[model samples]
Each structure stands twice: as C-alpha cells, then as structure tokens.
Target chain A: MSEPTADLLVVEDDADVRASLERGLRLSGFAVRSAQDGPGALRAVHERVPDAVVLDLGLPGMDGVAVVSALRAMDHDVPVCVLSARDTVDDRVVGLEAGADDYVVKPFALAELVARLRALLRRGARAAPATTPELGEVLAVGPLRVDLARRTVHVGERAVDLTKREYELLVVLARNADVVLTRERLLELVWGYDFATDTNVVDVFVGYVRRKLEADGTPRLVHTVRGVGFVLREGG
Target chain B: MRRSPSDSTGAVPLSACSPARSMSLRLRVAVASALSATVVVVLAGVLASVLLAREQTERLDRSLVPGSPAVLGSFASTRADLAVTLRGPTGTVRRVSGPELPLSPVGIPTSVTVDGVDYRIRTAPGPTPGSLVTVGATEDDTRARVAERQRLVAGVGVAAVALAAGLGWLLAGRAVRPMRRLTEQAATLDDTTSAVRADGSRESEELADALSAMLARLHAEQERSTASLHAARDFAAAARHELRTPLTAMRTDLEVLRAHPDLPERDAVLDDVLRAQGRVEATLTALGQLAAGDLPDAGGGEPVGVADLLRLAAEDARRAHPELAVVVEEPGADVPESVRAALEGLRMALANAVVNAVRHGRAGSVVLGAHRGADGGVVLTVDDDGAGLPAGEREAVLGRFVRGSTAGGPGSGLGLALVAQQAARHGGGVRLEEAPGGGLRVSLALGPDRAG
Candidate 1:
C-alpha cells in the first residue's frame, strides 16, 4: 500500500521497545523518527511535523496523552496513532478523546499496528466519504437533528454534546434510520473494523450517544432490539 | 496432684455420706419454731402453777380471818375442800381441818405437809385479843385443782407450739419457692435460652436479670468475632480470585516460550511474556494497597491540609506525565481547616485520581482543586478534559475488580477501588461527575476531625 515512503514519528519510554518498533517500521518501508520522552516527542513534532505520529501513552515525563493534547493545541493536523502499554478502555478513549486518530495496545502484533497506522494516514489524506455525509447536509428524525457539515447534533432546542466515537456511532445509526443494525454491522460501519469480535466498544459508544441525546428527558430515539442490535426511530 | 481413693473413683459412697440432711428453708423454719414453742410452754406452765397455789393459799387465809362471813360459812358448812383452825395467843400451833395443817401463829401464808398430804396454810391474829387464827386448804383438792389447771395450760401450750411450728414450715416453703425455681432454671441454662423469667421473688428476678445480661454480652462477643473471621476469609478468597487471571496468563506465556526458544516472533512473544508479568505485578501491588485500605485507623491521626494534598497530587501527576498540562486551581473558600486522615493514605487517593485523569481520561489538562463538600468534609477533585465514564458506570467503577466498559489499557482494576477504600477509612467517600471540558472529574471527600 506504500508507493512513497511515509514519514512517521515514534514516541516511547522503553528503549528496547522503541528500538524494535523503529527498526521494524523502517524495514517495513517507511521513514521513522524516534523520541524517548514527552518533551523530545513535542520537540520532534515542532521541528518538522511528520505525516503520522506513533505515541506511547506512558512516558518518563509528559505522557502520550499530554503529547497529543500539545500537538492538537499547536494546530498540527497530522494523523496520530497512540501506542499504550495499558490495554484498557479508558486509556484508549482518553487518547482518542484528546484528538488522537487511533490507538494500538502494547504487545500487539507489529503488522497490525502497521496496518492501523496506514489506515489512519490514509484517512487523514482523504476524507471518509462513507462516514461523513454530504457537506451542509442535515438529517432529521422527529426532534433529533444531525448537521453533517458542522458535526453537531440537536434535539428540539437543545444541542447535545457527544464524544468523537459517540458522534460516529450516532451518525452511523442515523444514516441507516429505522433499520435494526446488528452489533457486528455497527462495528464495521462506525469503527471501520470488520473483525471487532468480542468487543463491546460499539455498545459502549451507543450508550454514550443515547445518554447525551436523552439527557433532557426527551423521548427515546435509540431503541435497543434485544438479542439483535439497535435502531433509531421516532416511536415504537 | 495424687489421686486418692475417693478422687480415683470421682464419687463418694452413699452410705459413707451424711444422711439426707433436711437443711431446706422449710425444715429450718419448722425447727426454730419448735424450739421457741417449747421454751414458751415451760415458762407458761411454771407461771400458772405459782398463780394457782397463791390463790388457794389466799382463800384459806380469808377463812382464818375469824370474823369473815365467807370463812365462817366455810367452817360451819364443813366444806371438804377447805379447812380452818384457831390457836391461843402464846406459843400456839394450829392444825387446819384440811388434812391437819401444821402452822405457827404468824401473819403469813405457807405450804406444808400434813398427814402425808400437801397443804397450803396461813396464820394471823384473830379478832379476840392475843388470839391466833389459822386457815388451811386441803392438800388433795387444792393440789388437784392446781395440777388440773397446769395440765390444761400445758395441753394448750403444746397444741399452740405444734400449730406455730406447722405454720412456720408451710410459710417458709412458700417463701423459698422462687429460689427453688431459679436454681432449676439455672441448671438448665444453654445457648438457645433467650432470657430467664424468674417468677418467684424480687431477689430471684434480680439474679435472673444479671444472668441474662451476661448471656447477651457473651452472645454479642461471639457474633462480633465470627463476623470478623468471615470478613478475613472473604478477603483471602477475593484476593485469590483476582490474582488467578494474570497468573494463568503468565504461566501460559512462559510455557510457550520454554517450548519454542527459537520462535520466529520471539520479540513479540517476549513482549507478551513481559506484559503478563506486568499484570501480575500490578495486581500484587493493588492487593497490597487494598489490604492497607482495609486496616482500621489507630486513631490519634494528625490533621492534613486538603489544599496541600491536592497541590501535591497535581505536581506528582505533572512529573509522571510531563507532557500533560496539570494545574492546581485556587483553593476554594470555606474549605475545612484540616481533614483528619492518614497522610499517606490521603496522598495515595489523590494520586490515584490524578492518574485516572491523565492515563484513563487522556486528559489534555488536569486541574486539581479543593472545596467544602455538602457533608462538611474537604472535597478534592481532579478534573480532566478526557472522555468521562458513562454515568451508569460511575458507581460501579469504584468497586474492586470492576473495570468500566469505557476503560482501555492494562489495569490492575484496583485503582479506583483503593481510592474508595481510603475514603471509607477516613469516614468519607468518592464521587464521579462530568468535568467542564467533557471529561471526568473524580472527587475525593475526606471527613473532618470527629472532635470538631
């Protein structure tokens, strides 16, 4: 999938892990830059922003989450794929919530990480047309409204706040309104993952979306179809 | 310590033992009454006999008055039950018609023997000058009358004594009824008996109340110890269950490595092995912290500054995650002067919150702050810009081994649990809420000193 060498920055705390990732990614036909700590990673990015950044969540000083926040604060639109030794939902959500494009848990397959990085870079290059509807397009179901261009949602007169993943899930469900989309289908459609088996990430994000949407005691919109999946409709 | 013949058998022969001693309260009362009754009867009999003999002698003296009508009539009528006599003035002796009473001319009464019979006699000056008058009562009739009166008194006295003794025995038996019941109830004492209702006397009721109170105290002590024992057992069991997972993973990974030293994905395999080991280590540390949290405070704890603790936590978070922007907000007004808490424990709890914000929330900026909680405790909060946990899981995440569905990373799953444990130990609690910047804000409220 690489026609030209992709520029990448690798930030990690462990020396051996950093060395291995640098070597492996380099041999996999990519330009790799390495930093051992948070400050070093930030300096590397300030010097010259890479095409993509591979960040480790744990660092000696200034962890990966802070690094991502700094990059975003600096208006660096470069794609970020975080590497976390802590394989927990909170850690992944934190990275993504801080504007990281994706995350790879530690002890993960090198090939899988490479694949995710490639996918992130690819997404950064071209807009995700399937996930993002036509510009300025607004989809409405009952009191709920989604503005594709502004990336915002409203129910009645109130605007609902949603996390990035939650927004993605809502968009997917709204796009296929009144349809009972199974968990597998939602995972594939929203997360762009065909093999998210045994993961409740979809359900979790759906929960987030539902809570934000109905926070004001609004009528239920995201109705769950037990033993199946979920559906978005106005009423029963 | 030597065993004697009796000690060896642990029993005494019935024949060698004392008789079936009637030392009961009823027997004692009966014996006491009988002894008093005997003394009264003897005293009454002696008194009655003396009174009767004096009366007989007085009657005979009246008859010897010489001019007394009743005395003259008795002498003229020749009453067989009485006798009278007179004597000339000088050195005269008198013989009473009753059984020949022997009497000297003296103004006195006397008891004497006449004709082998008992007699009461009296002598005095007669109406004629220098004349002696004497009177006598027949010994048989007077003696018989005295004896009969004494016998009747004795019979009545004996009857009275028997009645008194019988009544005393019966009343004693009635009075000791409650005591007997109390002894019987005490003999049957067991764990299942809730209370002893002493139905007899006031003293017996007091004894029962005392025994019941003792039983209740013993029961409470037993219950308390049993509960603590169960708690310890549960702690061990929970620790075992929590440790099993990582240990199993490590074992499998180690077995794989041992089987294939030259595996193509040796680096990846090694990483897996290390990850498993890290999990085990993390779990062990968490277990230690949990045990620390479970310990009861020894009291006399020094007060801790709430604001200072928050600041320290922020600094620690910054040092650990240098890239993460951590700020200590201005301390809120009206906050407690100090919270009574274990310093190290409170510090660890605050640190856990910061780590949660930095590691789990992926917070861009963490702000540590303090305020006075509604419950009058010091509320220290760590606010992050990372994604907050779902509202439903806010409470669930505080329990041990309960990872939030939103959490991602290698976690011992005891981070928040330790925070909760510390809060509980300090007589406080932890609350989770949404932060200002769409992230989680974890608040640790430490109670103030109880003395306050």
Candidate 2:
C-alpha cells in the first residue's frame, strides 16, 4: 500500500520521542507534523486537517484524552493512534475510550506501531469506500440489537435501558456481529478517549451485558481471550 | 530478679514463650505422672499404716483380756499369794500372774489394766461362758506402749511421703530439662538466614520431628521462590531482546536526520522519531539492567578506600548538580580497603542521590560520610536536604519504574532503585532515614558478597 500524501499530526509531550516517531512515520512516506503538547496538537489540527493523528497520552498541557474529546466535540472524525510509554493493559483500554482509533504500548516495537497505524488507516479508508457495506446510522442483530441513531439497545423482545455508554458499546458490537472485536478496538469505538481510568469498566460493563442478556435465556456471547483481551462472539 | 531460685531463672518466662503445643504437652505429662504416683503411694501407705496398727493392738489386747478370767479363777488362793482368786458358776478359775493390775471397768469382761503399779481386774465368760479363768497384770502399761508405737509408725510414714513427692518432682524436671533447652534454642533461631535442624532426645523425639518438618518446608519454599525469581529475570531479558531492533533503527535514523540541515521537515520529523526511539531504548535498557541485577552485587569489589570513593562520588555529583551542597563528613572516616570499588559504586549510587536531593530534596547540607559499623563493616550515609520520601514508599521508591513526584525531567527513574540493588548485591543494604534537618537520608552499607 502506498503511503497517504495527506499529513499526519503527531502529538506528544516528550520532544525526543515526538521527534523520533515523526522521523519514522515520514520515512514510511506519510507526511508528518509534530506537536509537543495538547494545545499545539489542537492548534495544528485547526491549521490544517490531517489524515490521522499520532497522539501521546501523557501530554503536559491538555492530556491526549482531553484533546481527543475536544476534537470529537467539534465533530471531527480524523482517525487517531495513541502512542504512550505506559504499556499496561488498563492504560491501553483508557486511551482507546478517549476516541483514539488505535494505541501502542511504550517500549513498543516500532514495527508494531507502524502496523497498528496502517491497520487503523486501512479501516478508515474502507469505511469511506462505497463498495464496502456502509453500516447505517442504526443497525440491529439477532436478540442483541442496537439503535445507533437513538443510541439505545433492546435484548430479545424486552426494552432494556442502556446507558449512553452501554448503547454505544452495543452499537460497535452490533456493527461487527460475529466478528471478534478486540477490547482496545471496542473501547476506542465506544468511549472516544485514549486512556483507561484504572476501573474495570470494560469487564464490568461486559458482565453487565451478559447479565442483561441472560435475564431470560437470550443466548450467550462476549468471549475473552484469556491473556489477550475481550472478544464478542454470537450465540455459542 | 529475685535472689531465690525463682528470680535466678528468667528462662522460665522465656520457655513459656515457646510454641504452645510442646509446652502444653510437657506440662500435661508432668501433671499426669505426679498425680498417678501420688495417688498410688498415698493409698498404699494409708492401708499399710492401718493394718500394722491393728496387728500390734490385737497382740496386747489378746494377752491382757485372756488373763482376766485366769485371775478371777485364782481368787480363792492365799492372801500371801497376792494373786486374785475367784470361782464362777462352774468350776472355773481366773488368775493374773503379774502384781500390777489396775481396777478394770464395771462391764462384764475377761480383762485387766495396770497403771504404773496399780492394777484393776474384771472377769468375763470365755467362749464357754462361766467355765473360764482370768489372770493378768501390766495391761494398762502394755496398751500405752502399743499406742505409742502406732504414733511412731504414722509419723515415719508422713515423712516418707514428703520425700517421695520431692523425688518425683526432681525426676520429672530432670527428664524434661533437655526438652526445655531444645525449645529455647528453637525459639531464638532465625530460620531466614541459616538452616536449623531439630536435635532432641528420644523422650522429646516428637517435638524434634515437628521442628524438622517445618524447617524442611521453609527450605523448600525458599528454593521455589529463588527459582521463580530467576525465571522472571530470564523472561524480562527475552522481552528486551525482541524489542530492541526497531528501536535501534529508529534512533539511528533520527541521529542521521539531525546531521542533515537542508531538509525542512527533517528536523521536525527527527525530533519526534528520536523521542519515540529514546523511550523504546530507555525501556529496554531498564529492562536489561533489572534482569541483570536480579542477582545483586554478587561478590564484587574489595575494601576500596572509602575516602577515594567519596571524593570520586562528590566529583560526579558536582558535575551532575553543582548547585547542591555536597559536603563530606570526614570525622572517623575509616573506609576499609576491601570495599574501595564497592564504595565507588556507592558513590555512583550516591551521585544519583545527590542529584535527586538537589532536585527533590531541599537544597540543604548533603552530608556523605563513611564509617565502620558495630558489626565490623564499613557504612556510608548520604544525607539530602529534600523532603524525606514517605515512610510507606521509602522501600517502594527503590523498586523499578516507581519514583518520587519530584521526578520532573524525563529521567529513567532507575537511579535510587539501582543503588538499592547494588547494595543488596554486595551483601549490604540501603536505608531511608530522616536527615538531621528534615530531609531524605539514604545510608548505604556494603561489605563482601559473591557475584550472581
């Protein structure tokens, strides 16, 4: 695949790390603009709309999560890939929840980060392509159903009051029913942020979904990959 | 302490502090043995005393009572005979051969009593009724003698019993003495350092077995934990190896771009790339060092001059944080020659300390001193003027990745922790103390240790 000519905005607090990432990304052929902090990143975004963002979670001024949230509030949909030195599983989950498209744990292999960036960009490109099934603003699947437009859900024939969070979580799952969605990807799509709050909100909410679904034997789903992460499967 | 046997033995309370099972078992055995023997001896002595008194009384009574009838039968004899004579309903005669007989009681009987020289007499039918004769004297004296013998026997028996109880106690204490010593030794032992095996006699064989079993379990746990630690280090090393290549390439590229000034985007791109590469490389470096230090200062460095180490360390700190006060306390600074290099390592560790003190610790008197401890090893103390690391995190800050909030710059945060590791490797340790003027004081102790 050819590198995109559109520029990529890289936001990080550490000058040395920000510089290295831009150099590598540019070498891979993506045009890169660098920002040392959140204000700089947001300013850069306004100055020129980039194809994607490479954001660091531990920014000095406005954190990466706040920056993503602000951009989302402004109705921007540029794909984001979070880069941070905190490699913990919860950290990855937190970053994704803040609207990041993908994340790389620090001390991460550069190759892995590059691969992650490519995957996220590929997803964005496919979503825009007319040939790919354009998932409607609302979709429902089996007994586990979602209304993306209303941002709500229903289990079987019962109207379950889903939280804004739960509704968004269900929409992501419904959009890719029967497809295994990594916990990071799920968090990114639902939470619209790129950092974890150290809360087991992911596992907790998954348990909630399972509990609600099993209230009347509505079939089981949401399988976990032990050491990896969570994946939502269909019945059985 | 009491001057008595009681006060002389503080070991009593110390023994009481021993494990409850063995102590209780010993006490139970003592009580049971004493009780069983006491009951047997007391019952047998009482029965024997009663039977012996009865036998002696019977001998005196039989002779005295029979003679009464004989004396009565002789009542018709001559007055000069001085013997009493009497005739019963049949042709019976009663006579007492002795002259000292007291007047008997009025009740019918074949009996006589003698008090000193006086005599008393009485007659009674024998098994054949009035056909019996009675004669007796000195019966009163005889009964008094019999009573005296009985008293003597009872007194002797009481004394014997007291002796037996004392003897039994002595035997029980003597038998349990070795066991008490075994218990005392067991309680004082620090199993964390060296192995301890139970050594007790056959009587205390059970106690020894229990101790040995527990020690064996302790040894097994220590071994398992050591093995697990090695496995973790290996795993970390492997991870570092796998993550190093791309990080190297990224770093190289950034360094390359920095050398070229013509490209407009080169500098910007190089800055971000280098930053990323640095994080990756720093992580790898930290990981590798942590794994390598998994086995701390195995025996390395001899007694290097403490003064030399301190001076070298001060120079380093001067370069790192020249603004901070780095003063050496030369009083009683006798650093052993064997720990010279170890002290140098200490200085490196302390340079980090000085920098941190300069950074986070208040800029106060940073005293670095070296001296010999009471245990015959050199001790070095580094005092910083910064607010002391919290007591809770004093030990924790020495762990990998954890650092004080005062870590403002992009530091590796491995400095203090590495110092701890180095000290540990050298069969020594580092401690967190409150400095004289209220700041963080880290004392490093190093002696001899084998390399891991």
Candidate 3:
C-alpha cells in the first residue's frame, strides 16, 4: 500500500495462521517474511536481521521462550513481540523473562500488532540513533556502570552485552538512581507510550535489565517498592 | 437326626434355650418340685401309719387282764389272727385261743410269725398269782392300709410335676418375646431405612439404641458419598458446556474464512479465529489443572518458604504485566514448614490470582504477601488497585465458569475456581474482600499442618 517503514519476521508453526499473519502484515505496510519453526526463524534472522520479529510461543520443534533466549544470547538488539495462545500470568512471565520486548495474545488484531511493532521500532530509534548524538557518556550506579555513548554495560569487572531496549531501560534507571519510578513513568520515558492499554512492556524491559545487570552475581541494585514502583539504590 | 424336642421352636431366642440338651428348663424345674412334694408326702404317711399301729397295739395290751387267762383268751378271740398265751412260775407256755405262742419272761410287744402268719404279740403278767399272760395281733391289715395310702401320694406327685412343667414353659415363652422381635428386625436391616423401637427389658432397649446409632452413621456416610458423586458429574457437565462455547465460535470463524477466500477483511476473521482458539486452549488447560488439584495426595508435599513464594509470585506478576507494579511484603516471621499442597499446584494457584487482577481488574499495581493468620494458619494474599468486585458477586465469581461483573472480555473463568480448589485440597479456604487501596484482596488460608 505504501513504502514499508521496516521489515518483520513472522515465526509460527500453524500454516494458516502464518500465511494469514504474513499477508495481513504486508497489507498493513510492513515487509513481511515467514518461518515455520524455531530453527527456520533463527536461520532467517542470521541471513539478514529483520527490523522486528513476531514469534509464536508454541512451535513444533524449539519452544518460543527458547528462541527468545537464543536471540538475546546472540546479542541481537532487534525487538521481539511474542504471540502466545496461553493467557496465564506464568506463561506470559516466562516469555518476558526470556527477553521478549512485548507480547500479544493469539488472535490479536493485526492493526494492534502492527501498532506495537511500529512503537518498538520508533523507541529503538529514539533510544539510540545511527548518528550517535553527543551526551553524557557514562552512567554509574554503585558497582553497575552504563556506557551510553558506546551502548555497553558492565557490573564491576565483567562486561555485559544488552539488547537495545534493555540498554534504554537501564539508562533510565541509572539516571534516576535513588528515585523510585513507577511503571507508567518508565513507559513514558523509555517507550514513549502515553495512553495506557493494559500492556506490561515497562515491567518486561525492567526484568531484562535486572537479569543482565545481575548476571555477574553483583548485589541487586534495583529494588521494588511494594505497590509503588522500582528503585535503584546501593544496598537494597 | 437326633434333634432335641425343643428344636420345634427353631427361631426361639438364645435366652430361651436351656444349657442341658437332655431337658428343657421347664421340665427340670417341674421334676425338681415334684420330687420334693413326693418326699414330704411319703414321710408324713409313714409317720401316721407307724403311730396308728403303735396305738392299736397298746390298746390290745390294755384289753388283756392279768387277773385271769379268760380275759386274755377273750381278747385274742376278738381278732382272728390274735393269740393269747399263759405262763406259770415254772416257765411253761400254754395257748388259750388262736395259736400256740412262745412263753418268755419279758413282756414287750414284738413282731413274730407263727404257723406262717405275721403277728404283733404283747405279753403281760396275768391277775392269777404266779401266772403270766401274753397276747398277739396280726400286722397284715396295717401294712395293707399303708400301701394303699402310699400309692395315692405317688399319683398326686406325678400330677403336680406335670402342672409345674406346663406353667414354666408358658412363662419362659412370654419372657423371650422381645428378644425374638429384635432378632427379626436386625435381620432385615438395610442402608436406606433404620427403625428400631426397643420395648422390653432395660438391657434389650439399650442394645436396640446402640444398633440405631450405628445405622445412622452408616446412612450419613452413604449420603456423603452420593453427594460427592453428584458433584463430580455436575462439574463434568459444566466443563463440557464451557468448552462448547469457544468451540462454536471457532467453528463459525473457520467457516467464514473458508467461505470468503479472498475477502478484504481476512485479517479480522483470522484474528477472531485465533482469539477463539486461545479461549479453547485456556479452558482446556484450566480443566486439566483442576483435575490435578482434585486428586488426593498420598502425603502433603515438601514445605515451601513463605518468603520465597511471595517473591516468586511478585516477580511473575511484574513480568507478566509490566504495567502493573507488583511488590512483595517482607514476612514478619519465617515459616519453617512448606505449604501443604504440591509446590507446582500452589504456585499455579497464586500466579492465577495475580493474572486475574491485571487482566480482569486492570490493576495498575499489586501487593503479594504471606503471614500467620489469627487462627495460626499460613495466609497468602494478593491485593490489587483496580475496580474490585461487588460484595455480593465476590463469592459467585469463585465458581467455575463464573466471570466477574467487571470482566473486560472473554476469560476461562477457572482461575479463581482453581484457587478455591487448591485451598480446599490443602484443608484451607479462600476469601475475597475489598482492599484498603480500593480493589480486591484475595486471601488463601491454609492450616499449619499443610506445611508438612
């Protein structure tokens, strides 16, 4: 219909659902590519990375959570919006903890999925553009250090490779080190989402940031305040 | 077949049967009384006969005058078998009448036989100087009269024994009637009905009361089992009906897609189909978990730390809904014991509550915590900051296939039901109340023994 702003990779085991998603996304002005299973999805990304990935959690071979973990482990910064048939909290949390950016339940409107992908791409651009702008380079919060200029992170002596969304989320937390920021505040600052729609994108990114930052066995710097939000402090 | 005569009353109560097989109690008592009567009667008859015979012999001796042998001779002639004798100072004996008799100096009545005839003889001194007189009488008449009287006593004794036996049997039958009724009633007892009225001696009444109590207990057990069976059947039927809703929607969507291969609105139809599919999948998963929850465990699963459980649930809540702020309250005391349910099942139940808050209540924040309840039970709670359920609908929402009034869209409706099921399995219960922050607070309380 118009010039596609970005490319999307659709991974699903069901043939009809996959075909329909690809067709629907293409019609909605996204250059869409398709994969039937987990290995194919990985290979497709390896050949040429897409701007975004639409992953189905239930795959015939490897599970959707595994694929997400693998993508994050490879240091790929492309945002992943998960699609799952299960609507339980445990199921969703597993996917988010595996490093997915956003998730949409199965049978979601094509328009909504497309909108989420556009928002993710736009956030990526705003988080770190191709022409890196001059700004405060290093963010230090106790033993955790976030190098904004080079888009790298470290805990004490160990270096950590973070996805783009994770990096943006970490920078926000590091900037407001001692202050507790609510989920709404984080979404507005990091993803530029103004209107609330019952999405947990902020929490998911926080989970990713915490996992990567704490991977080196450093003391937890991000503390959660019951019924409030999160705080990055020294002790607890 | 050498059966006893009493066997004719085959269904008689055990109390009525005599220990001795040879004779019944009635006959034994009758025979004992008859023997006593016979002993008394025969003793009295013998005493009367002996006294009467002694008096008659004394009179005969009085009638004999020692003045002359003529007086003695007349007395002997008065009775046919009587004999009179005369003795001189020289010890000579001569018979005056009847038969000749032995002469002796001793003068006492004695029994003798003369000429093959039994006689009662008395001798005394005669009135003539230096003369002695003797008189004798027959004992045959006295013996014959005693024999006839003894036969009469024996006949009366026999009659008394028969009458006593008949009376004893009749009394025993009346005394055992209550026991016989009890036995018949007990033999026909069943589960559906139990009616025992004890109207007899105090002991028999007590026995009947005990039997009634046992039958009541049995009836209660049977009713409980039947009620549970009915509940299981109802649950199955309701589950089927719930699944059919999603299935019907899915079929319709699929049919629509097939009818319009190149329809412009294909994406919307596909979305609807997928949504229906998701509902079906969720309902199926919930049904499976519910079944697992219903199963009885051999032993309560290993204990889980309250702190760890709360933290895990908070983390999960945060991950699933990044928009909702989830916080874990620090526990006041460390719960050394684990939850009484399977770890996985408990976790599932807690996670479902958190999700319900975010998805249905649209809660922007949630707080999860655990503490010892006032009743010394472990309590796990999830408080949300969304529109809470109405006071009336709170209980109803816990039932399977029952959605909250404020539920935004389609839901499996088994989430809260699963929580309730797990609570019951652990000998616990779930409660819903308005949170202090203006939303719903779900509390799951489990007995302390659940930790085992």
Which model scores highest in TM-score?
1
TM-score-superior candidate, 2 or 3: 2
- Candidate with the larger DockQ of 1 and 2: 2
Error of 3 at A143 (Å): 99
Candidate maximizing lDDT: 3
| Window of ten residues with lowest summed lDDT in model 3 chain A | A127-136
Q: For model 2, report DockQ.
A: 0.21
Q: Kindly report the docking quality category of candidate 3.
A: incorrect
For residues A1-236, what per-residue lDDT tens digits would candidate 3 score against the true structure?
34346889999765456756766676667889989779999999999999999998867458889999999889887889888765556776777777788888655655567777887777766665542745667889898887776777888988987765666677788899999998888877776665465676677666667887788688888888888888888897
What local lDDT score does residue B239 receive in model 3, on the 0 to 100 scale? 74
Indicate the docking level reached by candidate 2.
Answer: incorrect
TM-score of chain A of 3: 0.79
lDDT of 1 by residue, B269-378 (tens): 57865876777787798788888778788884677676667777777787878898988887767876567778788778877777777667777898888877887777
DockQ of each: 0.02, 0.21, 0.01
Model 2, range B326-383, lDDT digits (tens) per residue? Answer: 7877737344544534554565577767766775565655888876765567777888
Candidate 1 global CA lDDT score: 0.73
Error of 3 at B350 (Å): 1.6
lDDT of 3 at B284: 93
True contacts kept of 1: 0.00
